[model samples]
Each structure stands twice: as structure tokens, then as C-alpha cells.
Target chain A: MADTIDARIWRGGADGRFETFSVPRRASQTVLDVVTYIQRKLDPTLSYRFACRVGMCGSCAMTVNGKPRWTCRTHVARLEDGPLTVEPLRNLPRIKDLAADMAPFFDKWAKAGGRFVPSTDAEADFAIVEPASAERRAADAGIECIGCAVCYSACDLVSWNPDYLGPAALNRAWTLVNDVRDAGNADRLDAVAGDAGCHACHSQQSCREHCPKSLNPTASIAGLKRATLRAAWKGGP
Target chain B: MKLRARAETLLWGAQRASAAVLAVCVLAHLATILYAVRGGLTAAEILSRTRGSFALAFFYGLFVLAVAVHAPVGLRAILRETFGWRGVPLDLGTAAFAGFLVWFGWRAVAGLFA
Candidate 1:
């Protein structure tokens, strides 16, 4: 077996090109380790992002061999036979080598009204939500999303429609929509009801297929679609 | 002017509803065509069965209208996403396509009745 892996990484902004580095392969090596070796041992200026080096932060997501995945968890053994191609997430502006500008991604979340609007005062008692209730379960299903843009990068709709709210934003909205304690339902529905919102998702399930947390943003978006329809029909937001 | 959120939601709902109608209509239309041609029926025979039958005419009329409603809405989403074309012109263009679909579809259906 070959002891070295070829890592071809994107090395600049929008006009950047891929730069290849050969790193010594070891047992149980991850894509992130390969990148770290190249940055620390080979070149000092190779830029990327990662935190919590486990699967929790979701900041280590990158396009590995043309598929969006968390580099911290993506072992090199899973890749097909070729040089490992690592690039920044797609459908976003690249800032540097392997670093995508996340402003658009986060902006969509705000635009979709992903923030929870507080309806209670500080002196108020904690709202009790039954854990087994349908709404709570639905909210729980998508609540673990770490804001990783893997789903966004994988979404074909986002690629085609640059203004799309993307999966993360819609999923955030969906979780909130189902939250009984959340006071932002009406405004969130209004925000996600339009062309750039939940209506724009084509149900491609690319987001569902690529999410590191196994969250189905596609289903969340469908929930948003239904919720928005009722809200829009009632003319309430 | 800001888009009417309710109207946009209704548009999405209409597209889905029309799509549901199209699914049934398309299957029934195809099955009818297959059944009509199965015994090697002549063109005159086919026309004879459809020409004066109010039931067949109504079914086809509904089918045509469903297609007219369904296709243009789907095309509207496609045009906006793929071509980056939106606003009044895109809406008007899809509406025109719907009109054209209805006209052409009814003309073909009407030929059988004629």
C-alpha cells in the first residue's frame, strides 16, 4: 500500500488554483490531519477553519473530492482512488485557500428570521414544553444543527438561486416554528414565505443527504412550506 | 412594492395542487389513449367515440386546464432560478405560456369533437 497521500487543495480566492502536497499517510488518518500537516509542516500560509476537532463544531466542513463533508471526521480511506481534492464549500464566496466567506450564509439565517423573538420577561417562569409532544419532537429533530454550511453547499437550489435562504436557515426557522415557547413564528413565517424562502426549496434532499448531524433540512423546509401556507392563508404575519 | 407574501404562498400551493391534478390527469389521459388504440381502432372510430361524448370532452377539458395551470408555474420557478429572470416580465411570460397551453391543448381536444 502507498504510504503517502496526495492532497490537492484550493489555494486562493475566487480565482484561486489547486496546490498539491504529498503527506505521509498513517493508520486512522483524517482529511483534517492531512491538511494540518501541509499547513504546519509544508506551508505555513494554507488557510482553513476548524474547532472542537470532533464532529460537534461543524466548522471543519469542506468539499472533499467534490463532496461536502466534515474534514475532522472524513477519513482518507473513504475517498476514491485519486489525489484528495479539498476545496472550500461551494455556493459561497471564497475568502482564501479553503476558507469561504460565511457572511452570505449567516446573513440568510437573519433574513429568514432565524433568531428567536423573546416574548417573556426576565422575571417570568420557565415555559414548560412536553418532551414527547409532536411539536417539540419536530423541533428536536432539527435542533442540533451546528450552522455548518455543508447542506447549503450541497443544495442545488442554492447554486441555481443565489438568493435562496439555503437549508440551514430554513431548518433553523422550522425548529423555531415548532417551538411552543418561541414568539417569532409569525415574522419567521413571513420571512420564509417568499420566493427566496421555503417556497424555493425543490426538495432535492441534497441538504439531508449531506448534513453532518444527519438533520433533514428538506423535511424542515417542507414543514416550513406547510406552516407558511396556513399563516399566509390566514393573512397573519 | 413589497411582494404580497400571502399571494406568493398561494402561488406555491396552487402549483402543488395543480401538480396533484396533473398526476391523475396525465395517467387517465395516457390510459385513455392506450385503451382507445388497443384494438387497432381507425382514426374515424376514435373520433366517433370522442366526438359527441360529453363525458370524454369534459374529462379532456379538465385535463387541458390542469396542464395549463401546472406547467407554467413550474416553468416560472425554473426561469427564475435558472435564468435569474424575475419580476413582472417573468410573471407575464409564464401567464402567457399558460394561455398558450390552454389554447393549444383545447384546440387539439376540440378537433376530436369537431
Candidate 2:
């Protein structure tokens, strides 16, 4: 706790600039720790969002040194720069002081029909699905998203084309696409296809590289492309 | 002739389609020379045979026009996409290239007719 670390956290409204804070650096101190220390001890009014400090909640994501990351798991020592400069995630509407508005980000998930729609009613017989099956395997690979908005912030396509469904939402839709029990697979596939959806993704692989969970959204998007193309061809042109 | 961004895409599609046509035309032209000149066909004999072939002349002329339009538009996009820069200099260069393709290809196509 002897070393003095300079922290620059984004402060104020949508048009705000970086507000600087200097604090005593501690051993094994995560970025979330430093931010918490500044808010609690230095300034009580400083605003930031975090639920679970252990990184499962996916709420502490902020851009560290121009790259989106889960600040809860990111160590202050690992950042190579002299001072850690924190900014709100890019391509999302900023609220104030490191917290960006996630409504649009999450709304696209609904618009993409990412939620599961059950096929059977209350009295229907249970359908058994093998965990080793191809559909189940595809779902297993992409179902770990905690809605952190990291992939959404990392995608350049989202920055360029604001209407694009983004990686996380599309990834969720892909998982649903493989769910044989879901009644809305065809509608979901049709919704996630075409220009403003997964087709617009240039395979930049930014989301793949930045996901803290190491989940590959590109593979899921590619799967959706193949499925949609096959479905489109089989049914008609 | 339109300059909208959407028009650019259509022009690019046309250019690509034309290049495919030119590729076939070029191979056919080379193969025709190789096969037809086996018996040392004279210049007079070549003219006599080519003069009546309006069908061959039209097809070759279409190939010539395609090269004229395709070469310049592709160079235009290449300059913009690769250099990370775009404006008057790039546009002028593309226009000049199109003019060059049209002039050279048309000269050849006209000679085939006359």
C-alpha cells in the first residue's frame, strides 16, 4: 500500500471529461477495488456500478486503457501505463461517470428474440434432449453471456452501424436457434438474419478477442448464417 | 453516371460482372488465334472471314465496352478502400483510367470491324 497510483475515472454527464484521483496502491488490488476505494474513502459522491465483486455479475465492465474489460477481475498492476485511465464502454449511451445506459444494448436482445419460448403447455409431456446431441452442444458453447456489454462495446460494426443487433444479442439468438424445445426457432432465425443483423458483422473478431468469458460469438453468428441460408434455400429462394 | 454511395455499389457489381465477361472473352480470343492460325491464314484471308461475322464482332465489342467500364470503377474502389483516403485526386485517377480503357479497347474493337 506504499505506492501511489493515479486513477482517472470518467466523471459527470454525457459530455463529461476524466476526473483524476490519486490513491495508495495495494497488493493484488483489482481495478474495481481501486474504484471502490476512491468512491468510499476519497469521494462519497463518485458514481459507479458493481454488484458482485467476484466478476460473475458482469456489471463492472469499463474501458481500461482504451480496451473494454471486466474491471472486477482486472488487476491495477497489469495495466502497463503510468496511470490507469478509465472510460465508459464505447458505442453505448453514456449516463454519467463511467455508467453507460444499457437499455438500448439489452433492448436489442429482446428485438432479436433472444429469450426462450417454450413449445409445450402446462400439462404436456416432457421432452428429453441429449446433452451430447449437436443442437445441445451448440447451445452449451454460447450460453454463458452474463449481459456484461463487453462484446457490444468491443464491436466496430456496432459503432459504424448502430442498427446492428450486436454480438451478444445475436449470440443469445444463436443459442436459442439450437434449442430444439423452443417454439420460436424459425422466427428467431428469420429475425436475426439479413442486413442489420448478423449478416452485417464483418468477422472483425473484436468481440471474440474481448469477451472476458472467452466465449466465441463469431462461431455462433456463423452458425446462424449457415442455418438461415439453408432454411431460406430449402423453403424457397 | 450517378454518384450516390448506393450507386457506387451497383457500379462495383456491374464492374465485377463485366470483368467475368472479359475473362472469358480474353481466353476465347487467345484460343481463336491459336486454333485458326494453324494453317498460316493470310491477312486477306483473315479479313475475308472476319468481315461477314457480325455476331463475333458484336460479342467482341461488348467485351471491349465491359473492360472500359469495369477497369476504372474497380481502381476507384481500390484507391479508396486501401489508402484509407478518398476525395478528388482518387476520383480523377479513376476517371482517367476509365478513359484509357475505353480508348484502347474501342480502338481494338473498331479494327476488328474495319
Candidate 3:
């Protein structure tokens, strides 16, 4: 292992450029550690975002060596032996060095009706959901999204169609769709049905490929496609 | 929003249905071509076998219809995603393209099966 790792980090907004910093390599060091070293020792102005310093929080996701990944989870030893190129997540407006504007990403979530709508009031008894039920299983498949925007950055459809609800949002909607206690199925189906919704996805599987949690948003989107088709066929919703 | 969603969903369904038809038609068409050429038949010989055959006409006509339906929906998406084209103009444009495919595809099929 080299004593110093060459890390090229993005340094500006939309019209940004990469700035190289020779970060001291450490055993089992993560990509986030390199960024922190650059910020603390080399350049104090170097900006980035991270929380929990673990994979659970998706806020540390960045384009590392041309791939969107959770930097906190990515060990430097796992990367190919070369100068590391880190950039802001794609398909979102760059706020500064490594942070992207998450507003548009989250806004699409609302557009896709990602929020859970309760079917019963709090006064009702606890709803017993079967863990082995098909709906529960389906919901479980995509409920782990942390909104890190890695899948959103990885999606080509989101880049092509700005109005796209994106993989993360649609995945959230799919989980909610499978929720037996949620009353937003019809509206959520409508939200994720159109050209900018599930129909927009070409099933490229980029989101599935880039997801740190290994969740399959493509399958979730396919589920939405089926649900929407059934709704359309029944002439309802 | 409801109307647009329904229309888009129907269009997606149409594309998938037509693609399934195209898949079968394409396989049949390829198999027929290989079978026709296996005995070293000329273009004229193949035409003679196809001409005046109602089954051939119907099959080829179905193939052409599927193409007419399938290509335009895909092209509409490409135009929208690649070139940022949309709205009524894009719809009308793809519709026109579909018409062109139907006309030209049927013309070719007619030449083969007439």
C-alpha cells in the first residue's frame, strides 16, 4: 500500500473543478476518512457532509471513482489502486464540494406520494400485520431506503427527465403501496404512473446496482407498473 | 392528472402487448426465412410461394401492425428523454411516424403476399 493516497475532490458548485490532495493512507481507512483528513489537515475550507460515520445514514454518499456509493462504508483498500476521484452525486444540483441540493430529490418523493397515509385513526387497535404475508414481504423488500440519493444519482431517467420521481421516491411509494394499513394506494398509483413516473424507467437496473442496501428499486418500479396497469385496466384511480 | 396517467398506462400496456406480438412474429419471420433459404430458393421462388397465400398475408399484416404500434411508443420515449421533446407536438409527431410505419410496412407485406 502506498503511504499517501492521491484523492481528487470536487471543489465548487455547478461549474466546479477537481482539486487533488495527497491524503495519508491508513489501514482500514474509509473514503470519508480521507475527506475528513483533507478538511482538517490539508484544506480547512474543504466542505462535505456525513453523519453517524456509518452506512446506516446515507448522507455520506458520493460519486467515488465514477460510482455512487456510501463513502462511510467504502474502504480505501477495496478501491482500485489509482488516484481516487470523488464528486458530488449526479442528477442533483451541487450545493458545494460534496453536498448536493436534496430539495429536488425529496420533492420528487412528495410528488410520488411517498409519505404514508394512515387508514385508521390513532384510536383504533394495533393492526396486526403478518410478516409472512405477500404484501408484507413485498413491502419489506424496499423499506430500507435512507434517502441518501445514491439510487437517484445512479438513475439515467432522472437525469434525462427532470420531472422524474426517481428510484428512491418510487421505491418508497412501492413500500407504502404494499402497506395494508396505508390508504394512499389509489393516489400513490396515480402519482407514480405517468411518463415521469414508473413508465419513465427503462429498467436499466442502475439503481439496483448502486444501492448500498442492496434493495431492488427496479422490482419495486415493476410492481408499480403492474399496479398502475391494473388500475388503468379497471378504469379506476 | 388522472387522464394523463391512464393514457400513459394504456400506452405502456399497448407497447408491451405489441412487443409480445412482435417477438412471436419476429421468430416466425426468421424461421420462415431460414426454411425458405435452406433449399437455396431465389427471391422470385420465395415470392411465388408467398403470393396468393392468405395466411402469409395475415401473419405479415399482423407483424406490420405490431411494428406500427411498438416503434412509435418507444420512439416517443426516446424523443422525450434524448431530445427533451414532449407535449401535443411530440404526440402528433410519433402518431404520424406510426402511420408512416403502417403504410410502408403494409406495402412491403403486400409485395410479399400479393
Best by DockQ: 3
TM-score of chain A of 1: 0.98
lDDT measured at residue A18 in model 1 versus the true structure, 0 to 100? 93
* Residues A25-49, model 1: lDDT tens digits: 9888999999999999999999999
**How well does model 1 score by local distance difference test?**
0.89
Which tens-of-lDDT digit does each residue in A1-237 have in candidate 3? 679999999999999999999988899999999999999999999889999997887889999999999999999999988999999999999999998888999999999998899999999999999999999999999999998999999998888889999999999999998999999888898899978999989999999999999999999999999999999999885
For candidate 2, the chain B TM-score comes to 0.75
| Ten contiguous residues minimizing lDDT sum, candidate 1 chain A | A228-237
Q: What is the interface RMSD of candidate 3, in Å?
A: 1.7
Better of 1 and 3 by lDDT: 3
- Residue-pair clashes per prediction, in order, are 0, 0, 0
**Candidates 1 and 2: which is better by TM-score?**
1
Task: Sort the predicted structures by TM-score, highest score first.
Answer: 3, 1, 2
Alpha-carbon runs more than 4 Å astray in model 3: B42-44, B111-114
Q: After superposition, how far is residue A178 of candidate 3 from its true place, in Å?
A: 0.6
- Tens digits of per-residue lDDT for model 3 on B13-106? 9999999999999999899888778869788888888899999989989999999999999999898899989899999999999999999999
lDDT of 2 by residue, B26-60 (tens): 99989999999998999888777777588777888
Which one wins by DockQ: 1 or 2?
A: 1
DockQ of the candidate models in sequence = 0.54, 0.07, 0.65
